[model samples]
Target: MNKKIINKYTSDNQASNLPDYQQCYQHFKWPSVTTQLNIAYQAIDSHLNTSNENKIALRWLGKQNQCVDFTYRDLAEQTSRFASVLNTLGLESGSRIFSLAGRLPLLYIAALGTLKAGCVFTPLFSAFGPEPIRSRMEIGEANVLVTTMSLYRKKVAKWWQELPHLKAILLIDGAGVLDDGCYALSKLMENANAGLPCVKTSPDDMALLHFTSGTTGKPKGVVHVHQAVVAHKSSAYYALDLHATDIYWCTADPGWVTGTTYGIIAPLCLGATMIVDEAEFEVERWYQILDQQQVNVWYSAPTAIRMLMKAGNEIRTKYDLSHLRFIASVGEPLNPEAVVWSERVLGLPFHDNWWQTETGAIMIANYASMPIKPGAMGLPLPGIEAGIVKRTNKESEQATLEVLSEANQIGELALKQGWPSMFRGYLHQNEKYQHCFTQGWYLSGDLAYRDEQGYYWFVGRADDLIKSSGHLIGPFEVESALMEHEDVIEVGVIGIPDDIAGEVVKAYVTLKSGVIPSEQLQKQLKGFARKKLGAAVAPKEIVFRQNLPKTRSGKIMRRLLKARELGLPQGDISTLESDEQ
Candidate 1:
């Protein structure tokens, strides 16, 4: 077996959506549609009039060994009832409805129903504290909030009155008794008619509002239109290898963009059976679910992969994962070691893909039919045009973007301006939206380089790039190199101010289980990294940490690490999942 490439067509038994990348890319065509297109209609209602209406659309597994299934017909009726309930409340089209709940059946219903009613749906992480929840609700001007009783009392009860635009609070699980403006969704659903027609919405109508936190300012409300479902359906077919009959599991919370795009919309729109787990990450439980559910396609993040790696490979043989055919990773650039480890132990390699909240769908991915390059972000999707470009001018208005022609040259990753899933704008920030575009390309703010074979490799974010002695270095390179060590499980790299070298590379590492941190071990790891990345590019200082700061979406907070190291203010920590002391 070759170490560099994971062959797609290992035998005649293997099958994929795109058997040939170039041929598929050249002949791809989006289906023509009428002017009125509702995402909810595309996902559910269209299936109602077909034989697929009885097929299971969602199979939700509760934390306590409970299972509930909803078919396409069931979902259509339930979501229609919810839409009728919204209409009864006098919430008109385009009303913003925010949901702050876990992986409950009602949350999914509310999301689809909002789109069915032509209202905008926004999801907030259930783990978020009061401040983060309040800030987002205020910014988005949430008109209706759907949540559980405990979440309402703990996070929203105190400040619900503060937001003037908040008209009602719909509790998903509650008895007859309610607050002043609170209504029980169960009772409302019982009374609502299930035959309510889906509102006619134009393709450009806003359907989803997703909040992404920045390093400094407040979270930006990214606006995605209903037309994004086109890209969502197509990308899932090409990127995720999703099919109508496959049982898929996407281990992402609906609050994040990945969960919404892939976890909810893409699967349903493609008529795939989706598995939703209510429990958090547990290695034993994950293995059991994979074995029992017979999940054919799995989508997850790099953080969960590292955690699984940390759990030891011996635990893997305890269960049968033979049903898993395709595995894809997103949320962050997957380290090359994880990809290789998955193939070695799990019998299949993970295909890593790259996209963001702004892009709203997968842009570049290692297709199901393509050979996997362990660390490279594979070719652009069929209708997408991506390039590595540099800005000639600093000013927003006068900036002249030039795509780099040479391979292995680092520059900003830019995409052509008109993908359907591309965010329409940052809700209230027009100037920030305008600044994102230059010369018909959307500047992605991420720095990367393309190899001679047309595979794109991620360097760090432009802001996270380090310059030492006039040499530019990406933290991902150092981190990936260090990850090759046997004992190292996770690594976060940053650049600290240095007297002579301008900015010097520093790394914070977390070792495997039972490995005690010592000066000798630290020195050994430092020597290993230096040997791998050279003296100048390797870390000048190495720190052993128990945990590194990270966002809920599993991205290491490099900016937060730099801020804490320099005693600078830690700004906008609303999306932070964990912190290191």
Candidate 2:
């Protein structure tokens, strides 16, 4: 076997100084599985008759100042009602229902309901504008949609007749009665009272249809099986170290995998209560929620963590956050410096985890209550086999995939093929599905290296490699260099095409509190990064902004920046923010 790509992180794992992180945040320790439903359904069936039925499952807070809570029993009943309602609208097993909402309790009800009743539940970015909403509705063949009346009026009302697949629109509101064109969700729930039965299906049964940003090209549909849901239970509880009673909150919106897995599926599978606040990140409000709610296991992205870091520890210190046990970051890797700052200021090291939409849920992460390294994304979950594929020194192409067996060499991240939660296939795109893997190994289009002790460190994305004037610069290295500065809160380094240098590195930054965007600070940072990283890798330009365009999960959209600069059509502005960047 080609050991270079095979054990990409093994060398780095061996070199890591954090021994505790090596043991607790380890990989490949769980039982093997082949399905998503087996895990989720088992939880529902086994617990349905038990007294644990009344345990709290969800606590939702809408963006418009609304609150609702549910127990397992309530979930069962609501899901059943959701099943009956959707079925009445003529949708059956294998049909599709699209839910367009952030982190609403109803969205969960509709999703689990659709699964039990044998329909594919597809949730899109709730922040997506009308165009994306219409496009997805058409492509997914989604006939039935559940959304608020406002979303209908703002997005779908004008396009209703134009949608050939969309037959009915259900409206949910703070208060409303059931009607023909629009059925009031509250009254509909009152009508369909009892619990619904789950369909007798194997792990291979289609459970969800997720749409991934066709960054490689066009948007494509990804199908996930029933067994994928159950696989997430272990991935969430074990890898995330989430507990049964912990008031957990993973800050991703329902549109993303992180939201569904951590925010809904995993928490419900473990019978843990979750806080679903449909609010964006506001420094004071976030701290207030963490303090007021006494949240225990808190999971957010590194981008958000970096923003909080820039917000200054002084604001966070005012709140009594003693209830929090595990503070974790996902979506993006946490920098070592930010991790140290979190430990020093927040009294906890923010654990990092890694996963892709194609993986269905988290494949690697620092487990709850486990030893953690601030910079590493942690080991693969119990049964996952991950390694690095090195670049060969052939005087020809971009890096060739080298399967590694040792530690400390940079390589393309690859996972052992055939995990239970692995995506079934891209919807209607067989060739595209097979293209993601090679020799039975799923190539995660990311770069990572292993240390002496088995921890995986994230490098930038495959396409994020910066080439400037015959020298290649890794954006993360430059971004990390800038992050060390006290004035810098967050930064994204992009390679802007230039006539002279081929491509010049431009850094877009968001600064810390009390730090004004001045010529003095700009020079100070440029000089600091030149010293930290070599002069060749230092950014040539700095564009300071209050924010950078990021996905709902807190990933900086570098493509958006590149697209805007090239004057190309901007794709997927759902998560982009102009004011932030």
Candidate 3:
């Protein structure tokens, strides 16, 4: 955990898809684009003629211990039936379909079926309240909604009538009293033909619309096209180390970008078996799934990892996880302690990666065949070109960029344009989308630096930097240091206004299960942080909390903490999953 590089692990018989990074990057080529390029065809129907047709495509575990499996042929037929249902409803190509439900078997079918019919698909968090659901549906101009009867009644029943573009509502769980334009999905699928052909689509045709929340505005819809599957297939092959025979499990809900890109599309494109659990995060339940289902490759977020760390290592000893090979973490920066802890307790280090909703695919990652530097974002993917740059003009119509040359020079992270999965544009916000690029580089708002060996390290977000007495501080550095403390389980740092300095660092801490919170322990933590980091970089003030504000995808809401502390407006709490007491 002392910034020491973990050497890559190799077996005598097994080989990685990317044996050497440079060689693969030099010879990498995108798949040829044909006239009829559809994601559904690539992910599902194309496997119909191969041996993968009989392989289990999905294994769904219900909340009540009900287990169901769907093979490639079953998926093709069910998705085709769903497409025919859409066709029978008079929905044309390019129509928008939005789904709001938990991880049900039918939800997966609906998603692939929507893409098969050449309609745009968007998935909403089932836990979202009424306002968030209404706003996203309104912004995306939802033409069809797929949900359960309970969700429709609780969240969408009252306000859905106001949306003019909504034409149909298909309830997965049939309702006793149906409203206008509402029909049970089972009834529609009963008579629909299962031989519906996949619609022909251009590479650039819109296939998915993912909404991302901003700090002070309505949710911005990020548009992605059918061509994204090319990047999806390649990135998964190299980054996730996925193979046709692997049992893959990505524990992200389809509401967020990671869930859709990796959880649903990427694995399917490679013909890998996917494990989907309809229950929320429970340490014992998750361990049971890994041991019983024999998942080979596991993709998860840092929040769940921290939760498991908090649960202690005793539970893991009861389960046999010999089948698990590679584990990867995303959604946020993985703390160095988590990486070290996983390696010691779980027998494999969690390889951290970097990407955003706009990218629509993994850009930087610690590959299975590469050495890992704890707390680093790893190297850029084979096809990605990443750099650090500084802005030249702040208040001019034509701003410019200066690419930093020296290593360890902190600057905004930027990516060279023209990646296939790169978002085409923001829906109805062309000006905003155009502002994201300058000199052919898409500016990522996150701040980062690269070491001499080309390993990228994440600083906090650009706006999250702390300027105290002429010293620039990234909250991630301070949080990682504090996380080394044995008593601290989770930490969220923010900059608070000070009289002498412009801004000072303030940290909110969540302690371990049995640790008592006393002023002496707080002072000890401050001293420990000061020892790890210098006085200027350490937290000026520390506060104890039961939990920190987080999104449904498990990213800490540092901006929310700063706003609540300063009594400023808490903009866009729609995605807020939990709040600190």
lDDT of each: 0.87, 0.73, 0.87
Residue pairs of candidate 1 with colliding backbone atoms? none
lDDT of 3: 0.87
Give me candidate 2's TM-score against the actual structure.
Answer: 0.73
lDDT of 1 by residue, 1-581 (tens): 34334343233324364458888888876666559999999999999889799999999999999999999999999999999999999999999999999999999999999999999999987866565678789999999999999989877898898899999999999677788999999999999989898999999999999987543456689999999999999999999999998999999898778888998999999999999999988999999999999999999887778778889899999999999999999876777778879988988888999998899999999888876777788889988999999999786458797899899999999999888899999999989889899889999988999987688888867777665543445677678778889999998888887643557899999999999999998899888876555575678899999999999998899999999999999999999986666
Where in model 2 is the C-alpha error above 4 Å?
1-45, 62-66, 174-181, 368-371, 390-401, 464-581
- Give per-residue CA lDDT, model 2, range 331-376, as digits (tens): 6556667666787788776777888778988888766434555567
Residue 208, candidate 3: alpha-carbon lDDT: 95
Q: Where is the poorest 10-residue window by lDDT in model 3?
A: 6-15
lDDT, residue 233, model 3: 92
Per-residue lDDT of candidate 3, residues 1-581 (tens digit): 44433323212212354458878867876667867689999999999989999999999999999999999999999999999999999999999999998899989999999999999999987766565678778889999999999988887888798899999999998757799989999888889889899999999999999977543346688999999999999999989999998999999998677888898999999999999999998999999999999999999987788889889999999999999999998876787888879988999889999998899899999988777777889889988999999999868988999999999999999999988899999898999899899999999888999988788999867667665532345677678778889999999998887643546889999999999999999999998887556464689899999999999998889989998999999999999996755
Candidate 1, overall lDDT? 0.87
Q: Please give each candidate's TM-score.
A: 0.80, 0.73, 0.80
